[model samples]
Target: MTAVDPRRLPSAFWYLWTAVLINQLGGFVILFLSIYLTQRRGYSVAFAGLVVGIAYGGGGIVGTVLGGAAADRWGRRAVLLTAHLATAVSTVLLGIATGPLAITVAAFGVGAASNVLRPVAAAVIVDVTTPEQRPRAFALQFWAINLGFAVAAIIGSSVPDRHFVTLFVLDAAATLGAGLIIFARVQETRPARVDPAPGRGGGAVRGGGAVRQVLADRTFLVLVALAVLFGLVFMQHNTTMPVSIRQNGLPPATYGWLIALNAALIVGGQLLVPRLARHRDPAHLLAVAVLSMGGGFAVLAVTQQVWGYLLSVLIWTVGEMLHAAIMPTLVGALSPADRRGLYQGVFAQAFPIAALVAPAGGGWVMDHFGAATLWWCCLVLGIAGAAGHLVIGPARRRRLDMLEPSSTTIGVKARGT
Candidate 1:
């Protein structure tokens, strides 16, 4: 594999990357929300799960679609700044709400505001970097996210339950800081109008046209479906895994450190796996990665000890590291330059889609059948998603070739790994 220097990427990417790291560092509330609800607020596990699903996932679905459209209609910088400010305000709202209704509404606000950043930020990355550089650019971005997450996990978990408000305030402050950075450093990168033909990846469409076009792309839809399945299996770590840890008699801090370990591994090795396997067929590599995730969660079904959970984290983290950089790059490759935000937005919805179903579904399953059953179901979902990816891989590659011929020709001396 060829080596690519991180410094070679444009300065805007670094600014965006730094802002992402800052946002994530203080973005610890979600990780501990379930725990906070169940242990601190005295909500039942099932109810907490419902609230998370409806508030976070439900709002995320709306925010994602709107944000994608807004990114295309407005500018990326504007959308990002607006969303960041909204996220900060909502985070504080969630912290102060007293009753269940207020809390749920506030959480929904946080979900919608925070999630709006996904498609726009992803669009910014696509806008600023060349195709050959995208993989490494995204890898670095993912690394920053997990690095912040690892630290947030430790800090959020270590604070006493009573001081959870401090976490919320800090999260809001960090979000504001990230927004200010974007306001200062990042510029508008939404592609200018090219041609009028939507079929040929041309200029931006007005009103519902972009949404209609993205929905019309059947191939991208299949990829989105695969992402949904992948997310379902992976999202269990937040929704169901914590409950499993507690049921096994492990403290919340144990879960925290375990999450930190997952991040540590990713931060340390995310760049390495992509470098080593850069030449492999991406579909085959992704299938193997998804299967590893399945196997890891499958192991979780039977393990009752911290060591067993640690092993589970190690296995799944490998899969996470491998797929992190490649998926978004594929989304960017598939999109027309003009509609990058919408395409990325539609793709981004897969996780929130999973979030919507997984928490509620996993909770119900665990409440009735047991945690083992839920983990086993994750294994099944992983296997199914892997098979689908294998079948669709060729079509996706052909589409990429048709859409981006220059993307395959590595002319840039500063090509990403």
Candidate 2:
């Protein structure tokens, strides 16, 4: 399969890419919110946990749906700028709030404000690129996110305890910088709305359109359900894996190094994804990715050794790389051009929802049934997810193929056909 050049993506995409990198680099608050709340703000651990889980997590989940609808109604550029600017403001508010109530509200704002960008940025990429260029485009965007995250993690760690406010300032500044870049460089990319036939009602209907359209899309809903399963298995690394490693007598630093390895592998291995996925069916790739992730955790079920843990990390990270790049494109392919933001938003919400559920679910399984049981469940879930994708993939492919002819004909006419 021939490689699609990333260089061919439009300037608008690059601007969006750069903005994403900047925003991610400044994403210091989420990583340290719990720590900051417990240590600096005099909040109890339980309170901090609640604040993070309920206020921030809930805000993030809500943001996707709101951001998607707003982007469809207003335009991608407006939503992107609003989210960035609002995040900047909220980060600063979180830094300065003295009371628990103030901090929680600010944190909620930060969460909602920041998460509003994910679907909008994804929609912009879809608007600017042809289907052929999309895989590479999303891959590059995913690479930027991880690259920024790696650097931010290092810089954030080096920050002094007394200088915690500095982190907030820096994060807000970076967010604003991203907003400025978008304001100056990026153009609105939402597809124009078309009126109904002359004999039809010709009335305008707004609000809840995205929700109705998305809910009615059974195939897309199936895809989202599969993603939730994959995410539940994948998110275990964050919640349960560390506990299991600690139970095995490994230090916290061991888990740290293992996670670092995951990041490093992604930073290095991600660029190859477009080429690796070239000319392949996305559903097939997604299935393989799910199996790899599930199998990785299943490896953890059998062994407690460091090498085994490392092997598990490697396998799951491979799945991460493959799934990260392809999933957005699949969401884009399935969505109508006009409602890309809403569709992307709904798709983006699947992981955060999984994140919310995985800890309790995996922890319960581990406590009652044992870690091995959880791992085995992951394997079963992975197989089930893969089978679902295989079943729905052909239908999605047929729908996309039907849409392609009209898109290609439009392109030809635009080129003076």
Winner by TM-score: 1
RMSD to true structure for each model, in Å:
3.5, 5.4
**Model 2: lowest-lDDT 10 consecutive positions:** 408-417
Residue-wise C-alpha lDDT for candidate 1, range 274-358, written one tens digit per residue:
5655666677777877887887888888887888899999999988887775688677766787787888888889888988898
Report, for all candidates in order, the number of backbone clashes.
0, 0
The TM-scores, one per candidate, come to 0.94, 0.84
Window of ten residues with lowest summed lDDT in model 1: 408-417
Q: Which residue pairs overlap in candidate 2's backbone?
A: none
| lDDT of candidate 2 over 164-243, digit per residue (tens) | 88989999999999999999999888767644422212333467755775787787888889998998899788567866
Model 1 RMSD vs true structure: 3.5
